[model samples]
Target: MKRSVLKFGGSSVADFPKIKDISLYLKERIEKGEQLIVVVSAMGKTTDNLLASVHDLTDNPNDKDLAMLLTTGEQQTISFLSLVLNDIGVRAKPLTGYQAGIETIGKHLKSKISSIKGDLLENLFEEHDLLIVAGFQGFNKEGELTTLGRGGSDTTAVAIASAMQCPCEIYTDVTGVYSTDPRIFPEAKRWDQISFEEMMEMSALGAGVLETRSVELANNHNIPIYLGKTLSDEKGTWIVPNDQILERKAVTGVALDKEMAHITITYPSHDRQFLSDLFKLLEDAEINVDMISQIQNQDGQQFSFTFKESDEKELIRLFNALKETYPDLYFKIETTYCKVSVIGAGMRDMTGVASKIFKTLLDADITFYQVTTSEISVSYVVDEANGEKATRLLCQTFNL
Candidate 1:
C-alpha cells in the first residue's frame, strides 16, 4: 500500500468542525487504498494559552514541568482528532510521541530527534488505516517529555516522513509559499516549487511557512514536501531538490523578521581572548547570536550581533553579569530592530544583488544598521517601523 504522512497545523484543526472537515478529507484519501499517518498540532492558541497559564502561575517555571504541561496540548489535539475521525466512521488510532517511538535528546523545550523506531509504526499499519500522532512533543532517553520549540510540529512531521520514507504533506492556513508575507504585501506571488536550500533560507529568515530544521531534515533525506491550504485543493508549493526546480529566479523571496534585537559590546581590551571568552559565555547560556560585526576603534574593539527579541531579557541579564565580571566592558542593546532578507538560489550566479538591495532601501529613505550576506541570501537590519516599507519596496524593485 502507498504510504504518506499528512501534518495539520493548529489553525487547520482549530475546532471540532475543522477536525471533522479534516476527517472527511482524509476519509476520501484512505478509501483510495493509501495507508496514512497523520500528525497534528495543538488546537488554535492552545499552546500559547498553556504557556500564558504557566507564566501566570510563576515568573519562572521549571523546564521539565513546562514541557510536561505543554505536551498535553498536542495530546488533546490528537485525541480530539481521533474522536472526530472515529465518529465519522474512519478507523483511527491516536498515539503520543512516546507511544509512536519518537526518541529525542536535548534539554527540555528544545530537544532534537535522536532516532525513531520505525518498526513500531510499521506494526501498527496493519491494524489501523490512519495513525494520528501528536506533533511538537517527544520523549528523551531519560524518559522526559520535551517540546521542539516553535514550529516544532513541522519538524515532527518531516522527521516521521523521513523515517517512513514517504512523501510529507503540510497543511496550513496559507495556500503556498509566497515571495513575501501576503499579509504585508497582498500582491505577493506564490511559487509552484521552491528549492530546499532557498526554502530553508526563507524559513530561517522568517518565512514562517515551514520550520528551518524541518527543511534541513527533508533536504537531507530527499523527502519532497507539499505545502498548501488545509481544506482547499489548490496547487501549492513543492519543496524539492534543486534539480527538480526548472526555473530559478534571481531573487525568490523577501523575508522579514520583526522579532530581532541588535546588541553592541565594547571593551577596552583588544585581546582576541576577551572576544572568545565573551562568545563562550553566550554559548554557555544557550543564546544564539547572528549577523556579527566587529570594529576596532581608538578606545577598543566593539562587537555587534543580532538575536531574537524573546532572548532580550536574558541577554541583558547576562551582559550585566559580564560587565560586573569584566569591569571594563560597555554594552548597548537596541530592541527596535528587524531583519529583512532577500533569498534565492540563483544568487550565487547573480551580480550586483547587494547593491540593488541597498539602492532600493536607500531610495525608500530607510537606513540599515547592519548588513550581512550568504551565498543565497542578503539581509539588512533596520528599524522595526521601517521593516514593512523596506520589504515592500524591495519586493517591487526585485519583482519578487
Candidate 2:
C-alpha cells in the first residue's frame, strides 16, 4: 500500500468548511491509491480558549486535571474530521491517543511518548483506509490523560510515522520551509528539500515550522517529512538524510527567535558543584536551556545561559528560593533578547561563516550578547530590537 502519515494543524481544521475541504482533498488522495493515518490538532483558538476557561476557574490548576481538560480539544478535532471523512464516502476511524495505544510517561502536562502498539493502528487500517488520531495527547500507566507540551502535535505525527516506517506529510498554513521566515525576509526562497540535521538545528535555533523533537525523531527513524500548505498543489519541502539533499549551500537558512531570555548567574566561589546543583533543579523543573557559556569572573565563576522567555516566571521563583541557600549569589534575567542562528550542512567544510555573521552585526552596530557555534550552525543572542534587522542582513549576505 502507498501508505503515509498525514497531520493537519489547528488552522487547517478550524471549522466545518475547512474540514470539508480537507475531506475533499483526502478523497482524491485515497482515490489515487494512498492509504493514510491522519492526525489533527484542535480547531482555531480552541486550546487557548479552553486554557482560558481553566485559568479563570483557578490560577494554579492541577496538571492532571488540566491535561484531561485540554485533550478534549484534539478529541473534538478528530471527531469532526472523521465524521466529515466518513460522510464523504471515505472509510475513517477516529481514535484517541489512548485508543491508538500511544502510551506516554512523564509529568501530566508534558509527557513523553514511551511506546505505541502498532497492532492497534494496523487493526484499524484493515477496516478503514483513514485512521484519524488525536494529536498531543495520550494515556499514562495509571490510565490518566496526559498532554504533550508545546509543538506536541508535530511530535505526535512524526512519532507515528516513525513507528509505521512511513513518510510523514505535515500540512500547515505555510507553503513550505523558507530560507528565513517570510515575514522577516520577503525574498526568502522555499527549499525543495532540506537535510534532517539542518532542519533540526533550524527548528531548535529558531524556525517554528517544525519542532526539534519531531525532526529529531524523523531523523533517527529515517522517516522523511514533507511540509506543505494544507490542501494546496504546492509540493512543499522535503526533509531527509544529508546525502539525499540535492544541494548544499554555504548557509541555507537563518532563523530569529524572539521568545528567549538570557540569564547571567554569578556564584561567590569556584564551586563546580553549585553549577551541578543548579542545573539539576532546572532539569527537575523541565526547563529547556541553551547557549550556555561558563566564564571565570574576577571573584568567582559566572555562567550565562538562555531559555524560553515563557519560563521566566518559573525561573524567577526557582532562583529566589536558591538565593536563600547562597545569599551572595547574583542572578539577572533579561527577557528582551533574540536568538539568531545560521544553519546549513555545508558549513561542515566552510570557514568564515562566523566572521561574516559577526561583521554583518558589527556594520549594523548590533551587539551580540552571547555567541555559540556547532559543526553546521552559529547562533547569536542579540537585543530583541535588532533581531529582525540582523536576520535580514545575514539572509541577504548568505543568499539564503
Show where candidate 1 strays beyond 4 Å: none
> Which sections of candidate 2 miss by over 4 Å?
none
The Cα error of candidate 1 at residue 274, in Å, is: 2.9
lDDT of 2 by residue, 1-400 (tens): 7999999999999999999999999999999999999999999999999999987899878899899999999999999988888888999999999999999998898799998888779887778989999999999999999988888999999999999989999999999899999998899999999999999999998799998889999989999999999988887999999889776888999999998998999897997778778988898889999998888977998888999987898899899888887788999998888999998888888788888988999999999878888999999989899999999999999987
> Tens digit of lDDT per residue, candidate 1, span 243-280?
99998899999999998888988898788887877888
| Clash numbers, per candidate | 0, 0
Candidate 1 differs from the real structure by a C-alpha RMSD in angstroms, to one decimal, of 1.3
